[model samples]
Target chain A: MRRVAIVQGEYHVVYQPGVVISTLLGSCVAACLQDPVARVGGMNHFLLGEPGADVPVNPADMQRYGVHAMELLINDLMKRGAQRSRLRGHLYGGANIVAGLGGIGTKNGQFARNFMRTEGIALDHCDLGGTQARKVEFMPYEGRVRATLVQDQPLPPVERPRPAPVAQPTGELELF
Target chain B: MPAASAIKVMVVDDQTSMRAMIRRALQDLGFKDIRDKAGPVEALAAIKADRVHLIISDYNMPDMDGLQFLEAVRQDPVIGKTVFIMLTGSADKEIVQKAAALGVNNYVVKPFAPAALKEKIERVFGELV
Candidate 1:
């Protein structure tokens, strides 16, 4: 099976049947889009939700943002002869791994949902918003998605020498 | 080059976890003065005030992507010579060539090990110890 790994801030569109596209997510969102009629599909992994109000935005950065990710993925699918009206979306990987960070994952998930609604695309499946990271794999032509949870790496155990056994004084005990 | 602890490094990423992960990795590698920013814009603002010796920035950010950020840095007079390492998930050859042309010192794909990060930095900055 041919497999392509999508990374953060990247998207891939596949026309070949049974080609698997995968990505690892930690507080990032990946949107899988497919049109069964044309047998074409694409996926995008985005790091941020949207530009904040009054914040500066560069057009080139749009591909890394959720709104742009969705747009790019859909456009690529359409370019491959997929019809927009028949597109189905599957969303995955928005986990709040960083504690006390104001819920970046939640914001990302919301943006994706809103974008799907606004574009009139059917969001059929989603695994989003939790403390656990995820691995997302999608077969665009088949429109099959599998999500697996990933746990954080634990620190390696430290090795320490056993303390030397205390020696008992034979003659007398001294008082401090 | 100076000791690893003496050099100042800045890490830019929109994801808090990414920033934290890089920071922890650097600390493990014996880098003492490490600063993290949420995006390229914030990193630029901080750079204007206090120049860092090295920058490890994520390719995708909200206000400015890594390419644009590298362009801005290259145009700057004060911090233009800072060592830069671009981090990304995709290893697109076109993007890599563009970054190399923009004066990026190195590139790292995601799911990398701390040892790999150390080796990459050492390739540009000499021995860590």
Candidate 2:
């Protein structure tokens, strides 16, 4: 029953039986991939789909991008004896969590779905796109996942009262 | 233009490992004056006490996130114009737009290599010789 928690821009692969990988998500995405035949699996958490062409990036930060995160996870799983053809994928997170933050969650979910489809990986389960944050736990060896909604929504910022306006002197004041 | 060795840089993050990593990268880039703070509050105080040329901060932190810190920096007249760079885990457009609105000079994604860090700084201060 060893537990491993990964934050944003990280991934974990496990072949042992008693290991569980976990992460919390808000406007982010996590992908769980496994091969039933090889009994190998892994999970990755990413912040966005792809960097804009203007962004200067390198290999060290690849995991923070969904396109690269998926590739890294699959490569790691294959290295551990998993077959790409036999890989089954489960997707989670991508919750909006907060309003006015844009639809980054929707974009992330779309990216994950498109990636699996383009890669020809079979999608076993998906839980994505809501206003609440989620806690996702994956049993990599078992190829099983559980997602729980942690909060309804983040509380709105408290409104503060504005100060009364100072009265301006009308016209020109006479020298006293 | 000040040389990299002359420019003072501050690295802020809750994780010591992340701060250390950023510091190492800055050092590798030839920066001599480097300071680090574990949270935004301490970082803000330090900046007011003695200003730095650049501030590189992580987006997610315990007391106050990077956005709030950016707002605070922008609101202060004395240090508002200092160069600011945000380190984020995501490249979400919303974050980019927000940071830009807050007057962030530049931003780098997490787990960046030294080369990328150099590029970001160079973009802000021009080529570091």
Candidate 3:
């Protein structure tokens, strides 16, 4: 049994022997994809909602971002002799902890789901949306994903304000 | 250089939680003096006066945007090259180009994982600390 810490800015691709790799997340997303039939899989914790966050020390930036992470996860598993046709995804996180941000969480979740769809990848499970954050664990060999929701208050139902009734103009209606 | 002291970082984001999170992330990485500001109105003056080794600022803000703040800082030779890292929500190519023109040292988009920020900050502060 090996326990590892995935620190900020650092990531790991563990070849666990039937063991699960886990990590904590909030707005940051973690994607777990596996080839169930082949029994090999991998996951990546992407920091931002999109690409371009990857900073290259020099002029050549690092090839790491949500989009890039997703692509890498698939490619790495494939390189390990996994079949792309038998692959499935499990995405987690994209919570909205900040106030008045009804769009951030939804947008991130949508982006992940859409990316999976656009790439012709099958997403078997997803534990996303809501104001709550999550901690996720994945077993690549078992093709299982576990997500635990964190301390987050339920978002109060939006209360739409009614517009004041417009008063009828008292001008003469002779023109009619 | 023999570990030129720990990096003293300052986080300036509009969201208090975000500022706190970034500060915590940096602190977890053993970075000291992780000062924070909710907006740039007060932060701009503080940047000019304070001896902050590095700055992680938000691009979109209610007051004084990140570009303006960076420009203002550049005007003064003191804090001009203060290892500026822009933490924003936008990843548009145009914005990235503009940020590069503004002399931004690094750009870490929002909704970033702790690991992601840690890597970038550590890389940027590798020399200072």
TM-score of each: 0.50, 0.51, 0.45
Q: Candidate 3: where is the Cα deviation over 4 Å?
A: A7-15, A51-64, A100-102, A152-176, B1-129
List fnat per candidate, in order. 0.00, 0.14, 0.00
Task: Please provide, for model 3 over A1-176, each residue's C-alpha lDDT reduced to its tens digit, 9 standing for 90 to 100.
Answer: 55544422234444555667777665556778787677787777655544322222221122234654554455457657676668788888777766676566677677778777766679888888777767777777777678888685443332221222232322211110
Q: What residue runs in model 1 are displaced by over 4 Å at the alpha carbon? A: A153-176, B1-129
Estimate, for each residue in B1-129, the C-alpha lDDT of model 3 and write its tens digit.
213236667788755545655766666556766778877767767877777878888776645778888888777777788888876542444655677788877777554555557656666655323
Better model by lDDT, 1 or 3?
1
The 10-residue segment with the lowest total lDDT in model 1 chain A = A155-164
Candidate 1 vs candidate 3, DockQ winner: 1
Q: Write the per-residue lDDT of candidate 2 for residues A46-110, one digit (tens) a residue.
A: 88876543344544555687865775677568668887779999999887876886788899999
Poorly placed runs, candidate 2 (over 4 Å): A152-176, B1-129
Task: Give the lDDT of residue B109 in candidate 3.
Answer: 59
Please tell me which predicted candidate would have the highest TM-score against the true structure: 2
The CA lDDT of each predicted structure is: 0.76, 0.79, 0.63
